[model samples]
Target chain A: MLGRLNHVAIAVRDAEKAAKIYGAAFGAEISAPLPLPEHGVITVFAILPNTKIEFIQPLGETSPIAKFVERNADGGIHHVCYEVPDIVATRDILIAEGARVLGDGEPKIGAHGKPVLFFHPKDFSGALVEIEQS
Target chain B: MLGRLNHVAIAVRDAEKAAKIYGAAFGAEISAPLPLPEHGVITVFAILPNTKIEFIQPLGETSPIAKFVERNADGGIHHVCYEVPDIVATRDILIAEGARVLGDGEPKIGAHGKPVLFFHPKDFSGALVEIEQS
Candidate 1:
């Protein structure tokens, strides 16, 4: 089942400047930038008391974030991650309900170092959904 | 300062169908559809343990949701709402920090019957951020 929301990922061209807004405006603590070559994005976590805002910038031209930015020049909210007790079971449930899981239908290691899987945007009202192991 | 994330609003063509996925897949509780004609959107709240996912559908063509749907076709995550202790103070802080507050720079009575204001997406790394009075 879906647990608490882990974080909302926003795709941006400049993750640092974006993180600065949260840090300066809301006084949120910010994590040092982390690069995930496997995911092809650099992430900075803007920590709030309740949840985090993950700013993701494209690592390379081939990165998905780059493609997303090309389509949405201003960059925008990319995907939302929600915690799940058992990601495998959650994936099964979603599959059974006709939701198309992104990638190879297998959980991959996400930025949080947890097993996570993404659902197709079309099945989620055009909003990409990620379920991460809690 | 920004408090916890209150909810993420998704603009969808059909709020009921969008809410159904959370209900069926995650067994999440869903609120009855409520029409907010003033905002020109019909809304349904999908209750999660940590926060709510708000599904919004356009009540009329003039609605902002309708315009978003026109551009996106399938609809998508429209904006994210974060709770704040003092919206006026938050607005002042954002303005002082060079963030553009959307609309007339005054808090409006939002769907939750609390004062709320939106920050421009361009200023927020492409994600429209709403700060609502807690």
Candidate 2:
């Protein structure tokens, strides 16, 4: 079962710049931009009271979110991640319930260094969803 | 200053139906659909451990999210709501920092019966942001 609403990922052209207002106006703690070449993203986290807002920028030519950023142009909420006690069990239930998992239906190390799997947006009412092992 | 993230609003055609997966798969508590005619929306809340995922359906022809749903076709994140201690003060700070508040630059009673103000997506990395009074 789901544990907590882990984080919301936003795709932007500049992760650190996009998180500036959160720090300057909202007083949220903004983390330094960290580029993960494997994930093809540069992540900047805005630490909120209950959860985190992750600002992600495409890192390379083949970045997965590059197209999303180009299409949105102004950046947008890319996905919402939820924590699960057992991601494998959660994935099994989701698959049994007819939800399509992205990327070979296997869990991969996610941005948070935890096992994570993504569900197809079409299955989740048009919103991209990520489930991470807590 | 900002408080906890109030909720993430996902615009969908069917509020209750869209939240079914959260209840069935994630074991999240799903609330009965509440129609807010004044706000032109019908809402179903999926209660998570740390926050809520609000599924909103347009109630009327003039509903604000009607166009968004039509454009997305598959439902997508409409906006993210964050709580603030003093909305007025927060608004002033955001304005001073060159963030454009949506509409006539005034706070309105939100779906939760709290004062809420929306910011233009252009000012916030193309993602619509809502600030609600805590």
In order, candidate lDDTs are: 0.89, 0.94
Q: Which 10 consecutive residues of model 2 chain A have the lowest summed lDDT? A: A1-10
Name the runs in model 2 displaced over 4 angstroms: none
How much is the lDDT of residue B21 in candidate 2? 93
Two-chain complex of model 1, DockQ on C-alpha atoms against the true structure: 0.81
Task: Give candidate 2's whole-model lDDT.
Answer: 0.94
lDDT by residue (A38-101, candidate 1, tens digit) is: 8899999998777889999999667877988787777799999999999999999999999999
Candidate 1 vs. true structure, TM-score? 0.96
**Tens-digit lDDT string for candidate 2 (B1-134):** 77999899999999999999999999999999999999999999999999999999999889999999999888999999999999999999999999999899789998899999999998888889999999
- Candidate 1 docking quality: incorrect, acceptable, medium or high: high
DockQ numbers for every candidate? 0.81, 0.86
Q: Which candidate leads the pack in DockQ?
A: 2
The TM-score values for the models, in the order shown, are 0.96, 0.98
**Fnat for the candidates in order:** 0.79, 0.81
Looking at model 2, the pairs that clash are: none
